[model samples]
Target: MSSSKTIVLRSSDGETFVVDEVVAVESQTIKHMIEDGCADTSIPLPNVTSKILSKVIEYCKKHVETPNSDERSLKRILNPLILTL
Candidate 1:
């Protein structure tokens, strides 16, 4: 399963990430390239640090599977509505 649609992304710190095409498509740039059939090779994300990129991937993975109900609920629950005079 990993071999068919996976692309290797090399970070500035020399860390490598194996990402699926579906996951990588969250990026608008990658999504366009994929739609145009130009993502046959590995995509390099030089500007993003490995740690940050990993976190982004994690968020995308979670959101892709489930809606962000907790975040929405938190905003609704925690934000105070104030009346101004």
Candidate 2:
């Protein structure tokens, strides 16, 4: 569904991640920025490390694919993410 739409995320470590526009806008902050027409170009996340950003993206992808996922299951899945951070 996200054929030609994409957004670039520049991580604090100077790593750039080109993600689907729909996926990138999962963050409420990004959604608001998009709604306000303030995020036309690459979005900079100066505080998030590349490792954390990657994990967050992975999590968002999983969540998006399973919108009605059980909370307990999510917690189990997320425990590793939490432990890593």
Candidate 3:
């Protein structure tokens, strides 16, 4: 069987998005599901929008695919530090 898992999320506009479990786990709500054994089925995210949801997924995918290990990743992850200075 495939070790990969999928999650279903519902947008505020009534759209459903099927995303990878890893990506979905980026959210605390979904993370809790995995930890509590409630991730076997589609997760209902009634507060999110499709546009914002897509952006979040994109960020998670980028982080998973090419995790910043050196300066670049560090900078991207902590860019706010520069502005705070």
Candidate 4:
């Protein structure tokens, strides 16, 4: 697929999320739906608000940009500091 492919997600608070298809798939539910051919259009997330979804998208983007770097994982981040102490 082209790198430019994106999927639109609609939040419960009437917010629209137009994000990379990869980023959107971070949500397991969405991923399954996509795999099952249920994501034909804007995926409606009636349970998650825009603010929360925005954060989720941010997290997704970060992980996508650095799949190997565990900077975002709490366990990875805390382990280093804990070891020092």
Candidate 5:
């Protein structure tokens, strides 16, 4: 695969994070934003707190890095509420 692009995400509390496109797209919400061209700048996650968003980003990065991991295991890492958009 070629080098993955990066995406910037802004949390509700104004915290910003730069993550790989592949990792960002792990969230259906972010995937749609990219598909709709709304990610040209930073994607704002107004409903998610910085703390929760950080956890979500970490989870996504791990998921993208480990393609062989089981779905059940992924679901166990964080609260289900945080996983949903």
Candidate 6:
């Protein structure tokens, strides 16, 4: 594997997260922004709370790391966070 580029994400609570571009693109919205060259600066997610955004990043990171992971596996990983949120 090669070193991947990264993107900066800002949550509604003003928290900033730096995530790999692959992980960041897990969101179609972010993917489009990246494609449109709107990600040169940090992408703002004003609708997402920091806690939820963090959980989302964790999910995306896992998905990127293990692309073959089954839906059940991903769901199991995300269920706890969903219930808490």
Error of 6 at 35 (Å): 0.7
The per-model lDDT (C-alpha) reads 0.63, 0.80, 0.69, 0.77, 0.84, 0.86
Candidate 3 lDDT by residue in tens digits, 1-85? 1228788877777778888877777677778977887656666667877776776666666666666467778568546544443
lDDT of 1 by residue, 1-85 (tens): 2336775666667777878766777678767867787656656667877876776666555545555558785444334321110
Q: How many backbone clashes does candidate 5 have?
A: 0
What is the C-alpha lDDT profile of model 5 across 1-85, one tens digit per residue?
Answer: 2336899999999999988888899999999999999997899999998888888888887777777877687667555646564
Per-residue accuracy of model 4 over 18-80 as CA lDDT, tens digit each = 888888887898888778887788888899988778777776776677677754584564454
Per-model TM against the reference: 0.62, 0.82, 0.67, 0.76, 0.80, 0.86
| lDDT of the structure predicted as candidate 6 | 0.86
lDDT of 1: 0.63
Model 2: CA > 4 A from native: 1-4
Q: Which stretch of 10 consecutive residues in model 2 shows the poorest summed lDDT?
A: 1-10
The model with the greatest lDDT is 6
lDDT of 2 by residue, 4-70 (tens): 7887887899998888777777788766767787766878889989998898887777777777889
Question: Which regions of candidate 5 are displaced past 4 Å?
Answer: 79-85
Model 5 residue 57 CA deviation (Å) reads 0.4
Error of 1 at 12 (Å): 2.3
Error of 1 at 64 (Å): 1.2
Candidate 3 total steric clashes:
0
Q: After superposition, how far is residue 74 of candidate 4 from its true place, in Å?
A: 5.2
